[model samples]
Target chain A: MKGLSKDRLWAIIVLLPSIILLGIFVYGFIGRTVYVSLTDWGNDPAQAMALHPVIKFVGLDNYKELFSGFLQSRFRQELVSTIFFTVFFILGCLGAGLGLALILDRNPKGEGLWRTIFLFPMSLSFIVTGTIWRWMLQPQGGLNMAPTVLGGQPATFGWMSSTDAIWKFDWNKLPLLTASVVGLVLAWVAFGAFRRAERTRAVVAAICAALLLGWALFVGPNLHLLAAPELHGFNLALIGIIIAAVWQMSGYTMALYLAGLRGIPEELREAAQVDGATQTQMYRSVIFPLLAPISLSAMIILGHISLKIFDLVYAMSGPDNTFTSVPALNMYLTSFRQNQFAMGAAIGTILLILVAFVIVPYLSSQFRTQEGHA
Target chain B: MTARAERLTPGRIGMYLILLLAALFFLVPVYLLFATALKSPDAINLATSWHWPAQLNWGSFRDAWDKIGGNLGNSLFLAVVSTLFAAVLGSLNGYALSKWKFRGANTLFALMLFGMFIPYQAVLIPLFQFIKSLGLYGSIWGLILAHMVYGLPITTLIFRNFYADVPDALVEAATIDGAGFWQIYQQVIFPISIPGFVVVIIWEFTQVWNEFLFAATLTNTNSQPVTYALSQLAGGQAVSWNLPMAGAILAALPTLLVYILLGRYFVRGLLAGSVKG
Candidate 1:
């Protein structure tokens, strides 16, 4: 009992400071936010609210307001945009990252140098990426002018500007091309490592190169019409954005793949080879199957990140541009700029549930399994 | 076709080419940033993308520097102070939780863990309101407190995992030698924990430095960090692309330097934190 008392005293001494800080600053703050979301806490809620003393015990009225088709309320638009951005962003990043990783895995001479080059964007904050990409995607910026210099006709379109926005649809004002392009750009900037089986790497490389090159030269040009159809030539903003996101995220995916790759028992591959299994068969049967867990984990993390991505979208889209108005941006404006704190918190609250749905379950299972194994 | 078909051949060149092309594709935006930064605004405003500047203008960097408070001092200060605070407080908390096994130890640990999954965006509005109420709104301390929330989770995770591996026998011996908790922690636990400490410091500093959402939303001028300052510089109409580019390069330098300097440690730390957590 004496020894136990000493240990207990020691625990209290060490624990109290952090508990106070994190509890108040983090968990406590979140609780306050949930409470705030429930009430009319905005700058002039009485004017916006239908009732005086406007605390809507509407339970999920704030959430239901998200589906409200009011032009002033861009809630549903933001939700749809977020969904598009997350799904496409995840697929692009993982796919491109895996592709890059496979190529780099061939034991290239300058592998470290290549790795550093690819990883450079990840180190740059989204602010830097956003600021720089905004400039590059401008009509006279690098993306357009580079082609003109090389004898191609100049692209007289700005991807982000309201006047030159990609979507022509007006009913929903759902800027499909704008959001998709921005998402693509974010993906390119995020993914860097894209690798798979070395044996199939060359074949895969040939197929991917042909597809990418063909897209760049042919399909990419046609898709540019989606950016600013009023302009004669195709706008490459959406494609460029997607490419950037894929480029940035590929490295992260590749890293996961590399970890999974290392985890593969060498004996299985050798045994497959000895059993007259073809190289493709060895990869198809052994390597890919074993990489499923890593792949699933990577997808979940990336998907959640893509949904909550604000920095990249903010950076690339700039505040004034309609294209940058992702769910995060929408929530920020609704709460801070538009002075609709309750509504914004509602969006954030919903976003939280979605992100949790994506990450927590998978992470818990993985961690629990790891603990069991340990 | 069956045996040596797997051997390296002309087909190998295709793999190399694909990687090289993808590498070039990945580098295009970075190259554009560098190219635009070096060029005159006139050069950037031209009808064609200039690969090399007509003349390298170092003056834009000077302008960018002045715009962002002439240096990264504020950012450096915020990052250093906040990171140090997080590391110290977090390590102490983790040691207690792992070693003590008190009545509410598990509850406290779980509470800290809960903060990890809640998106920063969720509490952002209320946090702003709370900060405003305390009159700490738009202050360096506000930013620091907010960042501490982020830094605490990672720092606590690192220390808890690291201290978990430390032998309990050594701690017991210290208790018997008339050493109190602080004395044992300072004299014994700290010295052996230098490597873990380095990882924590570097990780937290990088995160705080590179953050934008809080820095932009929390503070305005007179207390703005470089990241927020860079945003303001680049946010206005008729943007001086060259100057902002220069500002970005300068702003990114510290985080980049830290990452490069601690590349090996950073990678190990990341893998350790992720896998261990």
Candidate 2:
């Protein structure tokens, strides 16, 4: 017993340093950033950089301005672009990764070489990928001239510097749109739960969906975020950024799905074969269903990555290019370059909150499942 | 189950064709990087940018190395020191969490894992202030400290998951034979931890070497890593593309070489990172 107690003591001793460091750096620094975001620390240029400057408490003013202020359209558009980028990035990666993994599962020749070629991009820095892709995507050069070798005319598509946008919407309708989306998602969840015979989950989701949809129909229209219609949409320039991002990240999903595929027992395939299932039916019914969890995990990882992207955009299109700007890059420019510490902190906090929304639930579920196994 | 001779079916041919096309898609930019890097400044024209260089200009690489070679050395020092420190700390943490089985250890580990997913921008402001207050800002050591601190979560996670697979009987047998926590680790756990160390080392080294945001923000020009130097070299508006292309290859070589030599372990690290226990 004495030896066991001593071992426990040693365990504490081994774990203490990491616990303390993480407590301070991860949690404490986050608290400090939140505090800074609530104070006006950089309104005056001279005082902003002083050794110890006076700061005033300004609760939620910075956030309010970011969402609705006339001069902050860049932030609003960036938010819109981020949403569009995340959706398309996830879709592109899933499609391409699943395709590659499915093909590779057929036991093709040179399988190792093919995987190396496909995944080598995942090993490089975003800086290298961005630099190379920037050249390949130049509007007047590289890809535009690829057709000349085939005795065709050079294409004129603007890969990165384009100013066009699509799917434009008025900012005034944002509240309504958000409420409707939440309602629809809850409704879908309730339907799935009902189908699975989970009575409690189904009833709770049904009630939430009803309440949200009713409130949205009755009250959302009056809650306009903008005084007038402000157009925001998916910028065409993001196509270049999205293509580059998908190229770099799709290999990761392919790796994940390949592992998932390999984990399925050979007996399952034989069972399907004995049941007279064709190749396409076998994949659609057996393989794809088993891979659903992997797809969900990949989505969560890829979604968070797209949400906080910085270096690729910065390298491809420098910080001043508003068309391709993201919040991470904007935060850097606002704080370090422009000395707007408070505003920068606000953006950082908002990004943290957005990431937490996606990550918190995933982490909790992951750990809860791990606990069950333990 | 029978060992039948393989046949050249149309389906097989189509699959091979698609794989070849995908391979080409992935390799095109590499070909472009090399082709552009080999061209002379006068020979680099928009019309013929895709064509092979008529003359191999090794001078571009010489020029790039002259500019960013010191920064590459800085990156090497940073990644090595930080990876070593993080790996040691992570192994210790993994041993405690996995073998000790103390109360709240699992909860503490889950909390630590959350640190892995946060956007660093959230902590950038105060972290900068904290480092500056310690008089370490604008130095390579500060950057190394940042990487070590931030890298702990992932490294610890990987090691913890790796060690969890080691049968508890081994640890218990060591304990029964007059071994304490450190003794059991040094005798029974440490010997088996080489694979975990390899995975963590490759993961952390590649991450630190290829990282940009911290390097760009924390360091001055004199202390910048190769990624930041490459960014500055490429971000310029009115420069020859060959210089940045060559610099990209230079910045990417160390991690690329690591990937090529230890790809199996690298892929294991990649899978271990995302597929949480």
Candidate 3:
């Protein structure tokens, strides 16, 4: 009994420092950031940088301004850019990664060598990738001149500095669009649940879907996120950034999919083969279905990455380039460079909330699985 | 090999072609980095940017070295020291969590895991304040401290998961021999933890070395890591592209070398740290 108590004591002693450090650095600091975000510490330029700045509570104004203030359209546009970037980044990575993994699953020659070639980019910092890609994407020089080698005229596409945008939408319609998207997703989930005969899940999802769609179709059109029709779209400049990001991250998804592919039993493939299933049918029906979980996980991870992206954009187009800016970059420039501490904290808190939405459920599910195994 | 040989058809040809094209797509920027770095400032031009250098100019590397060599040293110091500290702390935490298994340990670990997924911007403001209060701001030590604290989650999670596989029977046997927690860890767990240490060390080293946000925000010019210096070099206006290319290579060399040499463990660490377990 004494020995057990002693060992337990030692265990607690050993864990004490890490527990304290994480408490202060992670949880405590997060609370402090949240509190800071609720205060007006930066509206006064003179007091913003003071050692002991006088501050007052200003609840939700910073967030309200970010979403709706006339002078803060840049923040609104950045939010739009982040959404488009996340969608496209996840899609590009998933598509490229699945293709590579599928090809490699054929037991290609020098498979390890090919994997190394593909994944080597994963090891380099985003800064290095950004620096190199910035040069390769130079409008006059690198890729634009590649066609010249093929005896074609030099192409004139501006890679990173383009000001053009496409698929423009009114900011006033954001609430409606968001509700519709959620409604559609829930409806799809409910349909899948109903098909699987999961009655409770189907009913719950159906009810939620119905409620959301009803609200969206009936009440959402009356709501507006902005006073006027402020336009936002998928900026053409993000295509280059997206390509560079996909290049750097697609290997990660490829690795994940390759692992998932390898985990499936060979007997399953042989069974399908003995049943005289063609290659395409076997893959479509068998392999891709098995890889769905991996694709979902990859999307979550890649989505969060694109959501909080800073360094790559900073290194490529720089902090001042409003076209390529993300909330993270804006937070840095706002808080550190401009000394707007409260505003910066607000942006950071918003980013944290966005990440938590994706991460919390994922982590809880992971923990549930861990508990099941234990 | 025989089965693969028998399957050589038009589809195989197309697959190989696709793989080759993908490989080229990935390799083009690397080739550009090297090609641009080898060219003289005067020789770099839009028309001939894709062409190989007429004469190799190693001076660009030399110039880049002169500009960013100190930052490289700082990065080396930061990565090595912080990696060592985080690895040791992670091992201890993993030991306690895995074998100790106290009340609420799993819940505590779950909370810690949440720290790893945060965007870092969320904690930047208060972390900056804390570091400044400690008077460690704008120094390499501040960056090291930050890395150590923030690095604990992934490192601890990896080691805990690794140690979970260490077989309770082994620890139990040691305990039966009258070994306490520390003694059992030292005699049994620690010796077998070499592989775990390798994975954690490599992961943390590569992360600390290649990391930019903390290095960029926390460190002064003299204490900046190679990534920040490379960013400055590249982000500058109207400079010859050769310098930035060379700087990029210099900044990337350590992690790339680690990837080349210890790639198996590197991938293991990557998969382990992704929180799927």
Worst 10 residues of 2 chain A by lDDT: A1-10
* Least well predicted 10-residue stretch by lDDT in candidate 1 chain A: A225-234
Name model 1 segments beyond 4 Å from true: A1-5, A43-59, A154-158, A161-242, A370-374, B1-8, B99-110, B165-184, B272-277
Question: Between candidates 1 and 3, which one is better according to TM-score?
Answer: 3
Instruction: Write model 1 residue lDDT over B1-277, tens digit each, in one string.
Output: 2223345578778877877887777778777778878888787765545567878988888778778853378788899899998898878877876666565555456557656656778889767867777888878888887887667877887887788888888888998897777887888788888888888888788778888878867886777888777777777767768888888889888877876777656655555444353
Off by over 4 Å in 3: A1-4, A194-200, B1-7
Task: For residues A31-74, write the lDDT of model 3, one tens digit per residue.
Answer: 99999999988878999978889999999998888888898898
Candidate 2 lDDT tens digits, A123-173? 999989999999999998888889997889999999789999999999988
Look at candidate 2 and tell me the lDDT of residue A368.
Answer: 82
| DockQ comparison, 1 vs 2, better candidate | 2
Least accurate stretch of 10 residues (summed lDDT) in model 3 chain B?
B1-10
Top-scoring candidate (TM-score): 2
Chain A TM-score vs. truth, each candidate: 0.72, 0.97, 0.95
TM-score to native of every candidate shown: 0.81, 0.98, 0.97
TM-score, cand. 1 vs. native = 0.81
Better of 1 and 2 by lDDT: 2
User: What fraction of correct interface contacts does each candidate retain?
Assistant: 0.55, 0.76, 0.77
Span of 10 residues, lowest total lDDT, candidate 2 chain B: B1-10
How does model 2 fare in lDDT? 0.90
User: After aligning candidate 1 to the native by TM-score, how far in Å is the CA of A41 from where it should be?
Assistant: 2.5
